[model samples]
Target: MLVYSDDYLEVIHRPASSSCILVTFNEMEMQANGSRFWGQRFCEKADFAALGFISRRPNWFPAASIEKAAAATAAILRQASERILYGHSQGGYAALRYRLLLNADVAIAFCPQLSIDPAAVPFDGRFTRHFAPALHADMEIMPEHAAGRAYVFYDPFHAVDRMHAEWIAEKQRETRLLPVHMTGHGTVRAFAGTARGLALIESCRADDVPGLRALARSVRTGAAMRPYQVALTAIARHPAWADRLSARFGNGFSSVERVNFLYHRANRHIRDGELATARDLLVEAMALQPNNLGPARRLQELDARIVRTSRT
Candidate 1:
């Protein structure tokens, strides 16, 4: 059922007999599909009543403002015994940003940015292109915005995401920072459709911190990102291992992961003083991601070193 629709946002409700209700915020649409409700299938499969907040644009759900968005569905949200706000990335920001406005019992945000406003989080330029003065002027997710307990999941190894999660934890005393390492910016993907993901969600809904801790432990070994992280680490430490893994995995890695492996393996070779081997690896990495500046810059540095070495 369509509860609310506006130029900037759409609210759709999937009714169920359960007393609890999950409110989901949609992430930025990469494909520009008309409008999509996040967690639609999961909600249906779990038989949980849910309200999906869909963004009409990648404007970070600022369309009519949080006040107006909440006002539109105040009565319906108030009727639920338990209200949990959930989303990933952009949607995750909205989950925390509107927790107080929506009177949520809990907020689960995965790899959420504290703010995309350049002035607020200049360290992260990844999403700055999407920032607009009119929409993101008041984009910071403050401590007061989190009405109840909030769980922020992010990879600590990802520098930008680490900063965001740390800032959130520092500002919001009630917020729990859960590190799902090695998933990089795609931390949510580690749990998206798996049994452990479902279990983690159930634990969050029940407010079972111990269970969540146990699940977190299990995730370290079973996460979907584990294999990729392992492969990258192995490649970085032992350049010879790259060829062995490549032969074994055989097209199992995505192009991005392959590029990452090549780049890191090249770095290892450079550290080992194998300039020729590093040059070859970097060239391959550049071939994989022609526009990537990391390998390009490294290749330039390598050329300079070679020139200096020959002169010496």
Candidate 2:
């Protein structure tokens, strides 16, 4: 059922026999194909009723305001005995940001930012372009905004995500930070469809903090990002091993991962004083992902270094 629809946001309701309601928020749409509910499939599988908050763009759910967003669906939300908010990235931000407003019992956020506002989180410029002052004037996810318990799942090794998780934990004493290491910014992907992922979700639903800690302790070695981390580590120590791994699993790597692998390997070569090799690797990476500014910028820097070395 369509609960609410606007230019920027859409709310879809899936009523179940259960008293519990899981409200899901949509992540930033990579392609922006109309409005989409984030966890529709998951909701269909679950016994609980669900409300999916879909964003039209990557505006970070600032279509109107948090108050207005809440008001739009207050009647529907009020019907539920237990409300659990869940989402990843921008959606994750919404889950935490609107917890209190939605009267949620639990919020499960994956790699959610404290704020994309440059003024608030100057260290993280990744989502700055998406930040609009008119819409996101007050983008910070404060302590008081959260209700009941909030579980934040993020990669501690990912510096920006780590900082956000730490800040959220520090501000909200009840918020639990579960570090899913080596998954990078895409921590949610590590547990998607796997037995471990099911266990993590069940633990969150049950509010089992000890189980979550134990699951975290098991660690993630087979995650999608683990290969990239392993490849990068191998590149730094055993170049031959890196080459062998690439030969074995290169086909499985996504274009983004391939580009990243090449970029990091180039950096390793530059550190080893192999500028020409670094340039070749970077050129290959550029060919793979031309739109990526990191490799393009590095290529320019490498050329400048090459020129300076020649002059010297």
Candidate 3:
């Protein structure tokens, strides 16, 4: 399911997991203004049981309003056994607020707006507006139970994120801090390009668990200069992901170079017995360059092979 406001909260269920993983998402545009537009799009990311509150805060949700929303979310998430909170931009701000209020086992925040209290607010815990998440109290974050982990991802080139990064580093917890000096905040691909989250997710698997511990050690150092390439590589390496992405985005965002890269990757998946994934990439190629018949024909060939194999 997808929770939508200005951004989308999607729960991705991988076959490797017996349960679903909820993703609380906030759109950069929506969170920029802090409005929660309700719809089915605002539904659960994964199973409501496995994943709970995905607060999508607008850019202007003050600091405390975001906290209140998150407090409500915490009540929802506690019902679930395993849960995580993730957000981008202002949404990240909300996720952090929620973590401060209810506390999640894990939170992935990207370019989160760390709020500073106005000097005139009487200094007695009454914020000028909403409840501030990162107050002086945040200086010593009292973890609820598990002593949760936070991985704050940001871009170094984006001076705004950099400034906030500097501020947050002061109140250090078990932090997975990443600075993408190359890519700015806007273009940072949370879905496909985030290495820290991927490493964490990969570690969950029993087989990759061994090497992942080492990878997890260098989590902050994994930011890529070419995030597009990183995303494509991730999709290519994972079965059916490229196809799923192609189906959703078409070739609108992908370039000619990306098309070619996907084609090669798609073919690799075909050779590796991932026909479903290969067919999806072929479809993406065909969509990107309709006049080029090679991909279309290749798709047909693959379909025919699938049919023949099924019959045999």
**RMSD after Cα superposition, model 2:** 2.5
TM-score per candidate: 0.83, 0.90, 0.43
lDDT of 1 by residue, 1-312 (tens): 877776777888888997989899877863223344788888877888898888877778883565676888888898899899998899999888888888888899999988999899989998888898977777798877778788898888778999998987787657888887777777887776646556877888777877776766666666666666666656655656656776677377788887787788788888989999999989998998999998999999999998999999
Give the per-residue lDDT of model 3 (tens digit) for 1-312.
222222323222212232333436464454222223221132323212233233343332333443444444444445545556666665565555556454556666677655534442222222235444443334222233122566666766556666665555555465556654434564235234344445554443223434543553344244332444334544546635655654554444445645665677778878888899889989988887887777878899999989988999
List the candidates ranked by lDDT, beginning with the highest: 2, 1, 3
- Report, for all candidates in order, the number of backbone clashes: 0, 0, 11
Tell me each candidate's RMSD, in Å, in order.
3.2, 2.5, 16.9
Q: What is the C-alpha lDDT of each candidate?
A: 0.81, 0.82, 0.50
Displacement of the residue 27 alpha carbon in candidate 3, Å: 3.4
Stretches off by above 4 angstroms in model 1 are 29-35, 231-250, 264-279, 289-312
lDDT of 2 at 291: 93
TM-score of 3: 0.43
For candidate 1, the TM-score is 0.83
Q: Write the per-residue lDDT of candidate 2 for residues 1-312, one digit (tens) a residue.
A: 776766677787888997878898888863223444777676666555888888877889883655676787888889888898988999999999888889888899999998899999988998999998988977798878879889999977678899998987888757989987778778877767546645776788788999997886565677777776566668878987887888788778889888988898899889999999999989999999889999999999999999999999
The candidate maximizing lDDT is 2
Look at candidate 2 and give me any clashing residue pairs: none
